[model samples]
Target: MMEAVKRFVGPKWRQYLAASLASYGSLCTGMSMGWTSPIFPQLRGPNSPLAEEPTLQQESWIGSLLVLGGLAGPIITVPLSRYIGRRWLVMGSNLPLLLGWLLAGVASDLPTLYVARLMWGCATGMQFATVPLYIGEIAEDHNRGALSSLFLLFINVGFLLAYAIGPFTSYWGLTACGGILSLFYVPFTWFIPETPFFLVYKDRNTEASDVLKKLRGTSKEAVQAELEGLQALVAREFKEEPKISDLWATRGNVKALGICVFLAMLLQLSGIDVLLFYMEELLVKVGTKISASDGTIIMGAVQVVTSCITPLVVDRLGRKLLMWTTSLGLTIFLGLIGVYALLDSYYNYDMGSWAFLPLLCLIIYMILFTLGVGPVPWILVAEMFPVKTKCLASGIASFMCWLAGFIWTRFFRDVAASYGIYTAFWVLAVCCGVGFVFSATLLPETKGKTFDEIQDMLNNRSKEPKPVAV
Candidate 1:
């Protein structure tokens, strides 16, 4: 049995398995993000367990506080991962997530629930900033794009699980299921090796070589050659500790940071967090015949299916094409939604007969979103920066993303209350249009390129500053 297992599990199996384990962290994060969708309405419903039903103001805080915690994740994760290594940090993140779910499962008051969510948010922040770094270091060039995309795939899976199951379970039951995810993730993630790049950084060349061999399923000579190349690349790029100022110091650095920050802003502005937090409410408001919970599940299913497409085609179709295609699609769908909402509100046009329209549009919007804006930004963040500056840049970009999410999630109810939800959809549509323009004119195609090659392209493009037409 041992011989058969050894023969069957090839060298690349280790890389695939490690990436999968890292993705489970994303699963937990997604569960945390999606939990409120089901629980919020329940807490406000008469069957609620709270001493008093939550007001809209309190509910908004519950929805937005996770982003607040996420905003703090990068501050700690960047330095922690740098010192202790990515694998341990990844393993350690599960503890807080588990605790968060446990607290949510048995909480007698809203304050306890808030603390639970904040803990989950912090774990999410750590996962987002660190998982990509780990995957980027371990994956071979040929499989890197697909492997990195798995992070998003698992996230959508978690979202789907939460939405699909939340309506069927009691509050504590749902929380228990979520906690089970973290519990399983903890032990499984323990076995994956630390990234070869980090090992080399610590001057453990021999161990790096062994890890490379295991990851690549290659012979000793091939592993040695790969290790030498990595050593040369690291030596050339990482002479000093990376600084925040390095993001602004050089032309390439400035351009990379600008694109990443813009992408992060565009991601949140596109309304993902809004949709996740309020999908059930939005569906109900649209007067869909479908139950709010059912609509949310359907949306989650669409997201998972579409997100799965990205890993298969990201390397083949290249990042630029996917970005533009999905951005344009999002723009059209969001615009239609805004138009529908406006017509229903002002013109008193009865939309009940066509209630399915908003649902259809939302489902399509989620599909396009998961395909492009959802996963591509993280992939680009992992790809665009130099190794030395990658962690800092990723942390800064992630902070921007969570901050935007915090603002949007916190204020969306106010905006909808004041200007109408149509206005919110219109605003998101405009953001999508802007993102399309950025992708067409500014973003470089990084398909099949080595890290050095990508850096060279950015440097050369920075020198001339010409836009690449779609």
Candidate 2:
């Protein structure tokens, strides 16, 4: 039966399945992140389920608390990633996500809602901390970029599900959708093999080789060649045994750390996550010709479609190209929206002739964003560090990302309330512009490169940049 299934799935089926299942973690996060956009209206409307409409401060907390909860997630998973291995860590993350949604479903007050979001954040943090580690381990040198980009693809799908369903369903029904999806993900993960890299690191050579055979689905000679190469690479990278403190101990590791952290910060500051969280509210403020809910649905659909196309092109176009192109595009569109917001605010300039500009600008921005900034940073982070420091290094980057999201989402309302949304969009445009420079000046192209080669590139092992493999 297993052989028949393997034949149907092709040679790389295990790698694709593992990545697909791991991405379900990101799917839960998208659902939770986009949850606020549609439901905030119901919660704040005249027919509210809570005893009262939440105060502005309370609303901010409700929106950002999941990110706040994400802050604590790495503290738990970074340590556990080594002890339990990547497969189990990913499988275990689903428990908290399921519980978080269930809690949100039963909540009658602000505090319960806060705790539920916090739990979801923690689950999200854990997934980000480990899935990239798992992905980096399983992917072939030839297809790493395409496989890693799968993370954001499913995330957009989850976002579309929430945005499409939220307007039509009751609050409890949406919460149930989140809970069921998370619960549904658990059993599928049980079939995937533990990463061969993790097994090699633990000196389980026989099991590692067996897993390699399953993953490659090739002749024993081919599997053994890859396995032997990995064993040698691990031995070299893990010299003297690494600790968490080593995340900043060596200059090379520190360089990798700085690059990944900066990229992660740029991703959040590009205004993608916060904008998704507040899509409906922003559309209302911009006063689009179409209804806010309809606009949100359209944007979500675009994200889902573009994200699928990105994975097909990322390996071919290369990382730096996509990052630079997307950053430039996001900057221009964000600046355009800021202009409309400025006119709409300071001048009370009625956009009678140009009402479509805001939505059009937004739709274009989402397209460029989904192509690169949305997923590439995660791929870049996964490629930067060796397994020895991956958990600690990736965890720090993940922490910075969530911190940025919390700061941006938590304060966006206050800024929009006082200065208008223009202020925030203009600020984020500057950030995206900086992202363009960062990609052009500092980021390396890792397309089709092996992990050993990437580490060598970071360590300055070669005077010239390695050419992207055909």
Best by lDDT: 1
Q: All models: lDDT?
A: 0.84, 0.84
Instruction: State, as a TM-score between 0 and 1, how close model 2 is to the true structure.
Output: 0.91
Taking all chains together, each candidate's TM-score versus the true structure is 0.92, 0.91
1-470, model 1: which lDDT tens digit per residue? 54554566554767777898888889878988998888887887776767788887888888998888888789988888768999998888887788898888878788988888888888898888888888989998777777787788889888888898888887877788899878898788888889999998888899999988888877879888789988997788778877778887878788888888888888998999999978888887655668899899999988888877777766678888989888999999999888888888757798878778889999988878877787788778778887778888888989999999999899888887788888888888999999999999899898778777787887884444789899
For residue 463, model 1's alpha carbon misses the true position, in angstroms, by 10
Looking at model 2, which ten-residue stretch has the lowest summed lDDT? 1-10
Clashing pairs in 2: none
Looking at candidate 1, what is the lDDT of residue 419? 88
Where model 1 places Cα greater than 4 Å from the true spot, the runs are 1-11, 448-470
Residues 1-470, candidate 2: write the lDDT tens digits.
Answer: 65775686678878887888888779888899899998898898875668899887888888889888888778888887667898998888887788889889888899889998998888888877777778878889776766777787888888888999999998888889888888867887787678998899888989998888877877677799888998997898877666878887766688888888887888888888778988998998875778888999999999988887887777678889999999989999999888998887678888879889999999999998887887787667667776677777878888998899899889888987887788888888999999999999888888888877887777788757689999
lDDT of 1: 0.84
